[model samples]
Target: MRPNVRLELIRKLMQQHNNPSFMKKIIVAILFVLLIVGGGVAYYLYNKGPLDVISSHAVEISAVNLYNSFLSDSAAAGKKYAGKVLEVSGLTEDVSVNQNQETIILLRTSVEGAHINCTLEDKTKVNANKGLIHIKGICSGIGDGDPDLGLPADVYLTRCFVINK
Candidate 1:
């Protein structure tokens, strides 16, 4: 009876080792677990909220200085300021609503035709008559200009809000 039991166990082990269905089952189980984990991550990211720039800490800088940094060395300035929230102070050159109905503020720079373009998060009216207004936004880096058209490089910021300081 002991010999028969040992033979039966060895036969079962060999069948399991040679069975393609056993390997297929294991592969299917692993794939199922991976799919579940992937779906969970996708769900979490899909429900995530947008960044709250109003409460976030920002780097304080002047519009001219920020523009000059990018003009002097774009790679260095981009590493320092791009995708970062900045509190920029400058004189208002123009304020208007774009086709998307978002408020766009242009801050004057030292160079001609060059401005710090800020796209506000909301449709808030800003009085350009006020001098040296401070704006907080995510710096989007500089936009190259057309020298033939007499346009200078412009700095861009998005999701901006007026900081009353």
Candidate 2:
């Protein structure tokens, strides 16, 4: 209505808004939430990067739901993820390390006849002492895998090991 009344109203509003403590707490809370969400998004995006485009490289992408890929799929996976350090989690079964010590790791995936290998950086001994373990390794091109060489080697597992869960 009147100018003086409007000025009083403005002053009241300013006083209510000048809550530094509350403002600080709200800012902190907002920042905390943003940091957490940002970190999660960064992690998720990092895990699902250019390599994991779900084009053959990703044996089991969290996004899509399809199974029973062909044996050659590894080749595609390799091509997509070549020279890149990628992580693929799968059940370890029939794992073995050969004399060459390439560390042949076997992973079980949802796709039938479709398997993914997490090639480790170093060779491991196929000792009975080592129990079933989750593995992480470098992604190598589907070349003359260990298995192609012979028993165990034919599996083409290189730089293998048991993943610590």
Candidate 2: count of backbone clashes, pairs at least 3 residues apart or interchain: 13
**Which candidate comes out best when scored by lDDT?**
1
lDDT of 1 by residue, 80-134 (tens): 9999999999999899999999999999988988999999998877786748899
Model 1 residue 2 CA deviation (Å) reads 51
lDDT of 2 by residue, 132-158 (tens): 344434445444434564422122333
Structure candidate 1, residue pairs in collision: none
Q: Candidate 2 — what's its lDDT?
A: 0.48
Least well predicted 10-residue stretch by lDDT in candidate 1: 122-131
Q: What is the lDDT of residue 136 in candidate 2?
A: 37
TM-score of 2: 0.37
lDDT against the true structure, per candidate, is 0.92, 0.48
